[model samples]
Target: MFKIIDLNTLGLGQEFPENIYFVLRGWMDSNNIIIKGDPNVIIDTSYCKSEKETESIFSFCGMKPDDLDMIVNTHNHADHTGGNNKLQLLSGAKIAMHEYDAHYVNLWDESGLNLDFSDWELPKFSVDNILTDGDILSFPPFDFKVIHSPGHSGGNIVLYDSKYEPLLSGETILNGDFGSVHCFREGNRALFDLRDSIKRLAQLPIRLILPAHGGPITNPQKCIDDCLRRINILIKEPIKMGYHFIRRWFIHAVLIRGEMEREKLFSHVSEIENFYAINKRYIKINNKDLFNEIVDDFIERGVLVDRDNRLSVINP
Candidate 1:
């Protein structure tokens, strides 16, 4: 387990040339990376709520708003790009993302299904540069090679710096498994492409995986191998995979409120068209009955409990 350290105690405002600092806090456990070099670089700006915190972090690293040279976004997700406009305005740094994802970054309303973006407002911004696969970004002592890893999102990319031994992976490759493939959009939840992307990443010489969420993964190979093994099993037993997927998100939504009405839970999960899309593609099921079945399945498996028409996670 990664130790959760208080950012204030780290004295991040101190200067350390040629070092990477992680600002991991706020909503979604958002991680904003600061790379100290000749042309200082920041990766993923986290959510809107983290704007002030991110600014403080930059100051802690002895960097002012205008000190940023470039802001690289891993994808178009709101949480990752929410602070883009603010940071750009404050630092006047050039914003860069994949061409496919650039549109969403500038729009502020393009996200996957079932995600509650009501609390945040994405400000429109222009892309200063467009990044593509195999692109090499030079930051003095470190050179990061961009790898386009789609599945979680159409334009997701992972940055690899072998010499530094850190893979700046967004949400594409999590520590133990691939990020969510069941998105709101139809083609966005492409499981096959996600599997291929994971396989491609496994071949890389990655020592550390700095993900957008959770803790940084030190045992890169083991995480990749475990993810692959899990995917293989999921491929063979898609229904079980689907069950776990639904259950995972279902519990997450409910846990947010401690408990929720059964109808409300079903309504929320059913909103993601990709959920049924994936199910229909794999299970060959038709109709809304499967949604109920999945909910009942979760209850039966003891992953959840239902009482008085309300659903909640089974507390351990």
Candidate 2:
């Protein structure tokens, strides 16, 4: 069962203008922000992972899954939107995401939806309503204006509350870390978009940031500044960024799939297309070389407990 806690207790000391609840999720899934009101809205379903977990999703936020009026996805990433299909089926809730991102979901494009990247059993889910920039969605006591923040992915969005000064930042801006920027197709357009999106949010009157990945961010401005500095580093040093990206994402892959064959990473990342682009355009190294580089980086980071040939986040 998912435990729902008050936002204040979850580290946000100040009370918001509405009844907002937070759910802490495992590393395999994203955290959730629930708005309990006339029409209950769950910001993200976290990651349903498998169909078996869907059976008990109704227990979230003290309401049955079917009672949920809306399932708002912060982005199209697998961790963020994997549960869309099952949740919608239970609640018949109107699923909403940025208009730009809706293309992947509506068309069931595995690559665009990031479904190809994850080994999870992510079912294709349709978007009931397309959320465009400036769209205002009200869930009773509070209303949010949609901000199309397309740096993390082409369709990632930030929900802004002008009156309350809080915004749902998704994976774009986190406590100390931002989303992983890979050298995918379009070259470095995603990188540029991330910079622009952060700059745009910096201009907003934001007091708090509710992100999809990390826990809630109270000091959004400082976080945005840190994101800009990190972006500069990423842009200036794609080689190092590439190495780090592989390391972090590999940690994720190992965490979810569990102790994958070390060599399998080459084939797995090949499916993402960006791996080739990273090597050809920026890193200028073969997959094996890059893999070795990332392994060294991971060891230095101490997140790698198992120094064996296989990659694992836990000690075996």
Candidate 3:
């Protein structure tokens, strides 16, 4: 089930004024920030399942559907932009996102990203504006500087405000851990880009971080630093990172079903479109080649045994 956290209970204090309302929804606690001002703006709508909840939130803030002027999507992920069509239709708001992600948002299934958007009921929507790095989006009371931060997903962006010091960090950086970049796409899991994006964000004098998931982060610098440290470790120990990724899903699959046929496991993965669980890490396989390689590595490590076309967890 999902829940909502108003501005007052978020513990942001006076730093975040009454104008900003963070709507937390879904199992992952995806956040949709509603800024109350002239030409009200909404950052990242949650999944379609949370549409009603999102509407109620707007009403609670004394806002009608037509009150919203703009809808900005941080990325093309289904969870982030699932409610775009609904909100846009209701509010007649102009939807804006990076040009690179614009097509993906419209033709998600055909993007070959290996993601399952069936459950989310993602609707096709056209991008009203194409945003680029260094573009300043001026919507009364706030001026957001778009910072192109890829790696988690191609075309991912972070909105920064110099004076306000609140970074609308999409999935680039979270409170404790960073967003997952191991998905199947050309530039989705570019490790070098992820490192560069994090480094770039670390240089900013950010006071608060309003991420897509989790609560608002007051210690922005430390969070970025911690993420950088982890990324550095992954860069140095590539094999270890691969093993870590494989083990997480391997254990999850075995624990849930006790034993799984090799073909059945592969079929299940195709259906879900990723290895990670809902609301958990976002690591995913981009293709069958990588999937087989990971499985072979697990077998060689004696963590999993493949016998009679079935894969099972090795007893300790």
Candidate 4:
């Protein structure tokens, strides 16, 4: 009977009880769920920052270090599986995850380089068993089916409880917005496929969603619509303008101001990248051309006025 500790913001850290414990805010904290069963089960060990944090979590739950049964990962992202090694060691639990992310888990060094690797150092860890879609993990009295909803990542899987009719889809169907599909290195098809996957989930009777980011939504239909809207923008708006057009739009949207100087606009560009979580390196490699094209389109559309190196938004 543990109570939830609110982190104030809806961005990070929070806990909910019901055999399910969402470590971060918005059901996103290194998700750690406890399944009610013969021996009890725990799902998705969180990005354990330190042994002390892990111990504190267990202590708050009135659980001992050696009490965890089964630890599973929704995918191979560091935030989702950062504490695999520590949790397993403390609880003597078996680590489970999609086979596709096995390499990421096993090779994860404490460099914060998994999903949040570029910005944060991810602790190294590994998985013991490979899981797949449609596979049911039984804890007796309750069982969850793995829904292969790959889009955020190749190995992404959402756990569904037939009894509760709820989904523990880490980062698959976030509330307030959809999950970010910015893994350009993984290929654009992955992002496009995500659109299809969410549409399929929209048909389900899921009442509650446990997403990796943003708040959990009781209204599955609304959540699905929100996801569709965000994704459809990628398909409809981005495509209409082409990759280049979108890039320029981002630049003008972020960097340009009426009659702003080049240096000021350039600084704004950096701010835009941060706003969209766009990496400078990635923009140079994959999106530079597309970004420039988008800028040109913005110019043609009268959305922006680019003079020499100076730029500013035009009245829409």
TM-scores of all predicted structures: 0.73, 0.88, 0.74, 0.67
Clash list (residue pairs), candidate 3: 184-286
In model 4, where do residues sit more than 4 Å from their true spots?
1-18, 22-29, 36-39, 107-117, 237-316
Ordered by TM-score, highest first, the candidates read 2, 3, 1, 4
Instruction: Give the best candidate by lDDT.
Output: 2
TM-score of 3: 0.74
Q: Residue 124 deviation, candidate 4, in Å? A: 2.2
* CA lDDT scores, all candidates in order: 0.69, 0.73, 0.71, 0.59
- Candidate No. with top TM-score: 2
On residues 1-316, what C-alpha lDDT tens digit does candidate 2 reach at each position? 3455556654555567546776656666777877878888888776656334543544644677778889898877777777788878877889999887888888988777665554545667888889988899897677899988887788888888877778888888887668777547324688889899889989998877877765677787789899999888888888767765655566676677766667775567655544555566667877777767666666567665544666666521
Tens-digit per-residue lDDT, 1-316, candidate 1:
1133333343334332346776665424357788777778899887665577667677677788778989999987656776888988977889889877876655544453123422234566777889999999887677889899887778889898877567888887776876665533525346667778888988887767778876667778898888778777776776756654554444545555557787776676566544555566555665367767766877888877888988877741
Backbone collisions counted per model: 3, 0, 1, 26
Models sorted by lDDT, best on top: 2, 3, 1, 4
Q: What tens-digit string does per-residue lDDT give for candidate 3 at 181-253?
A: 5534444346678889989988898878888987778888789888888877766766445544445534544
Candidate 2: RMSD to truth: 2.9
Name the TM-score of candidate 1.
0.73
Residue 243, candidate 1: alpha-carbon lDDT? 59
